[model samples]
Target: MRRIFLVYALVLVLLSPAFSFAAGWRDGTYEGWSDAGPRSIQYAKVFIQDGEIAGVILREYTDRLVEKDWTCYDYPPFGEAARTLGTKFVEAQLAEIDAYTGATGSSTGWMQAVERALKKAGDAKKEKQYFDGTFLGRSEVADRGYYEVVWVTVENDKITGLQVQRVLADLSVLDPDTYEGFPLEMARQAYAQELIGRDNADVDAISGATGLMNMLNIAVRDALDRASTK
Candidate 1:
């Protein structure tokens, strides 16, 4: 009887990780940097039920508060902003797997830390339901076809991922000089900040990238409409 009990205990111990995450939320922490310069933003995230990421919850530091004049009216949703910032930072760490479109800097920082946390916990998946938007080919330009191509990924009626690239090999269409050092990376970074956490199918077209942005708007609309039917 003692031998059987020991075997059973060993089996459970060996299979611990597989059964550990049945329904409980996973908690994690990481540090993020601000774009405004030398500001250190520390963040934490709790993975709630159904595996949805519960944004970030920022902690306030005495030094930070002391540096600025104490003004309540000017302060926006501080917690919400931290979560937003934290979400981007976590997303940044997963770049090699798939990167966000517009909010690159923040995304990179968050993702870098997230990747470490996830790796340590063995929680990384190739693809997650993070984005829910549909992919609508590329945006059309004049006679040259698509000046810049756009791809949208959405989840929960929100735009979650976006990718922009020159359409195939159609280099003749755009002026090489203007786009040369423009850093095509900004599109991904912008999509991250502006689209995530917002209602899908109604994403505001990005300021520039006219036609490409419009294409993304249409894709988001289509994705939400499809999600509604289901």
Candidate 2:
């Protein structure tokens, strides 16, 4: 009986999902708890990239922040009712933006925990930033002296947009309406979609568009280099 119990217990432990947590969570949720504020306990989750907090989600809050517990004659703005809510933080794209007006203490507590988590993450990755703006890059045309031009836009340290144009000696752009060769439109679409929301240095060569890919890379590299130097 004792041997059977031991074997069963071992089987149950081996099958549990907690064992999988060790290997599968590179991009995963991390929970942070604040020293409870007057209204409720606060919890936060931050998403990291390579090692920096790229995004944040406020996961839990107490009852006072959620409910307006009092009702009066023609009155709806007292107690927790008039407080600045946690929703403001979630709607904000960047955590550094601002603190809720009436909820200064809560916001400070929430940011304190998040800042601690960020410090922990910083140890995992080197910090990086990009110059935000639009840049034009050109690759010399073939021996015929025509060149390809590409525009790459960087904002908030990410590649947000790109455009490509092939120019002739007269500097007139080829009409996209009449051009059907080489899938330029498709290549352009692919480049823009794939490069957006990623670091400029992290772009990879797109398949089936090798030549244009190289040209685009040259233009983008020059553009990004110019941004960094400024």
Candidate 3:
């Protein structure tokens, strides 16, 4: 009787959702990026082999379009958190893990980046395209020393609303309402109007505000990624 019970438990364990997910991964390397922020964006590269997480590579890109050196002691917390997160990911074989003390923000960013990478590595087909929620996306600092942030709301697979914010190199927020004639403001309105009710960020660029329009597209796409179910 005990032997039979052991066999039954083994069957149940094999059929568990977690076990199924563990067995359904595609063996390969996948990459994902965090939502861009004022200072930097985090990146994760996940290596999967035989349906298991083999390793993870973490990186950060600064506003100046350069990779951050984790070796720098000026921010010891970030460097330590970055290293520890990579190990925890492999050990747990999961993206969700406890945040490192003093580096909660970095930990959250790294986890999201890892989650995105693992999503790409999943072999199972997703039932839904996106999860219904409001997501924030920020653009990489542009050559002109400005960036844009967008709050996107998704419901029933369609975009319901968008709120746009532009930030200068000095991190000052621009008021679109008062800056009516500004090219960036004009571009923001044009793009936001075009994106409403759309499921994706494929929209036409504003002529004089091409650069800003590109930033808008990237920011919108980044938000959509966070909303993605797959």
lDDT for residue 128 in candidate 2, whole number 0-100: 42
Q: Which candidate number has the best TM-score?
A: 3
- Model 3 RMSD in angstroms: 4.7
Q: How well is each residue in 1-230 modelled by candidate 2, as lDDT tens digits?
A: 99999999988887774343222223444545444333444445667544334457553343222322333313332223223333443344234446556555556656654543443333244244544555555664666555666666777778787777777677676765666666778887887777788766345667887776776777677556534421
Descending-lDDT candidate ranking: 3, 2, 1
lDDT of 3 by residue, 167-199 (tens): 778878776666645465667678778888999
Better of 1 and 2 by lDDT: 2
Give one digit per residue, the lDDT tens place, for model 1 in 1-230: 99999999988887664343432324443222121112322223324323333444333322121122213525544433433565543343331323334534434434543433333334445243333323433334446444443345556655556544454343433433366544445754665567766665354656665554566565445434322311
Q: How many clashing pairs per prediction, in order?
A: 26, 2, 0
Best by lDDT: 3
The alpha-carbon lDDT assigned to residue 121 of candidate 2 equals 38
Which residue window of length 10 is worst by lDDT in model 1? 61-70
lDDT of 2 at 200: 69
List the candidate numbers ranked by TM-score, top first.
3, 2, 1
lDDT for predicted candidate 3 compared with the true structure: 0.78
